[model samples]
Target: MPLVAPTTIQKVSGESQVEVPDLLAVEEPLEIRLGFGPTSNRQQKSVSVTMRTPGNDEELAMGFLFTEGIIHQPADIVSCRHCVQDAQKEGNVLRVELHPDVIVDWSRLERNTFTSSSCGLCGKATIEAVRALTPGPLASEFAVDAAILHSLAERVREAQLAFAYTGGIHAAALFDANGKLVLVREDIGRHNALDKLIGAAFWQNWLPMGQFGVFLSGRIGMELVQKSWMAGVPLLAAVGAPSSLAVQMAQEAQMTLAGFVRNERFNLYSEPARVRLAQMV
Candidate 1:
């Protein structure tokens, strides 16, 4: 499946309208199926169905599983592949095989399985639910200069190839303490983008990403904070404002949360100590 599709649209400007060719970010539904249980008694069930761009299905699946507390590490996954039961469902269905030793709590998944790419983990009722899966407060001394943090948004913008073409994609990027771009993932859904980024790191066995920072191309929501915290990322910066719950969660986790990061300025909502400023404001 192509990440972008060509379409003809009406270009209107001050009563002037013309049909022109344009590019659009592709969005498709990806059904994530889990195959777990003892080898003698294997079980397969559709865990989630999210509308997302077609690329990075495996990463998205793995990341989703990890964030949702289904699988802890990459080793827990035996394999992730497209399950093409029918030609029509070739790229839309993905089956993840977990090690037989991996114990699955199906009841938990059933309660959160129906998710959209836009709204992640929709049925989550309380912050404590997330806290149960998240680790303790981040105690790492990892910090970055304020000036370096200011440049992270531009770095993500430069690397957002899909956003450049469609102007409708969201991005999540991982950066080192020096503000160097490590990797980026783009999707129509912001949550999916972050999942893809986390999944990539998970595949590399980079769980508990305490040494790096995560940058979002949009507002920081509670779910985003939860995902970052699950990955053990200490710092999360975003181009837009954050929700009240997001700040609360970040503060509780001792994670640095920066929002509205642009124009040489940003708001540090929590763990300000992790960001060094030349002169305190």
Candidate 2:
């Protein structure tokens, strides 16, 4: 499906209104189904359904599964594709076939998928529920200069093709220590964008992204931090602010968390040592 759609809207400027053609970031529900169990007794189940801009869906499913602790490595997936059994479900339903050896504990996955893209961790009983799935504190020596961090926001903006048209999409970008962009993904949902980026990295064998920093175009939340932590990304920066719980989570995981990463300034919430600041003359 297309990432953006065309619509007509009234352009109100000063005192006059004129109808003009415009584009909007498309939003649609994507159902992610899981195929697991032994060869002799295969089973399929719908794991999650998230509203997102339609693109890079396979990567989104892969990223969601990995971050949700369903699969560990790229080898865990046999195949991931859109489900077409029902023509009506085409492009909106994805099925991920996992290696038979990959055991899935369904109990841990008991939650509604209807609101996952918005209310992350809504049904969860405790924060530890997700913290347990995430890897331990990051220990990599990866670091970036404050100046380089400041430049990332503009780089991300320049690469956001969909946002340029709709101005409603979010993005997740991965950059090397020198501030070079490695990958970028955009979606109507912030978490979905991160999932797509991580999904691409997971398939490309870029897990344990210790040498790279991930930047978000929106505010940092606890769920976003958890997802980045699951990918082993040491540094997480955002153009917006970080939630109190997100900062605490990053601190506990020993990850470097920075927010308000624009205008040559940013606030470091955790692991400040990883972001080198210039000394006074």
Candidate 3:
């Protein structure tokens, strides 16, 4: 939570001087470590590593595991602990231990290396590679009103404290069945904010958020859709537009996808039935 102070300087412009204040941004390195199988006896396997903001490290780690198809239920996570043994060597490396009998495909994980907060898949092959890893599409026919989708932008924006302060952070929020904001997180990177929110939900035993929806402050892309899909969230709303591939994936997954949510208006690219435009009037 450290920030550099803004500075003001004067420059000679002919016979005049000008001063301006510089904004200070906070950045920190967060390392995510996976411990699979049995937290009681402390038996675990290191899966993937990621660099992110220091806050919400545990949630980020748990959300990562769920999205990556490593574990299904929250009980599978034995414990997520921040390791300080090599504090000097590793800056804020979190070690997550999982329950026994947990199955992990190390071969698939090894194929991909470190993931950045911005882009979840750094060393993956192609879009098809991600598609292959995703679990089968969802089957439920969940629905929400278009008015709710449009209002999501304002609710999400109101909850973004970091963005309000620095005007330089992305937010990811979860809403309940009634379109009420339940949880929100902000970070310099969109994915990191999502991971932090997911990670926090995981620790709080809020996984399988089947009756809820996800809202993003940025554009809806494949990575965001994949993350929401893995979390068992059936609907995704964004303040911006979505990529073509994202729409395709949402259709395949049977998930409702909305973008360009602004001023009580939005575009439903897929699963229109899920959004009740008629209910608003």
At residue 105, candidate 2 shows an lDDT of 73
Residue 157 deviation, candidate 3, in Å? 1.2
Name every residue pair that clashes in candidate 1: none
TM match of model 2 to true structure? 0.93
Per-residue lDDT for 34-135 in model 2, tens only? 999999999999989899999999999999888877888999999999988988878999999999999997765663122223234642333455567766
Please report how far candidate 2 places residue 180 from its true position, in Å. 0.6
- Compared with the true structure, all predictions reach lDDT values of 0.89, 0.89, 0.72
Off-target runs (Cα >4 Å) in candidate 2 are 111-127
TM for candidate 3 is 0.80
Per-prediction tally of clashes? 0, 0, 5
Model 3, 1-281: lDDT tens digits are 34223546575789987786655346666666766554456554556555454567677777777777676778887778788689574546778777777877766555433232333343233344555666567665567766678788887888876666567778899887688898998777778888777877776777666788889899987778778777777888888898766776688777889898898778888877778757435
* Candidate 1 deviant stretches above 4 angstroms: 110-125, 279-281
lDDT (10s digit) by residue, model 1, range 142-192: 899999988888878999999999999999999998888999999999999
The TM-score values for the models, in the order shown, are 0.93, 0.93, 0.80
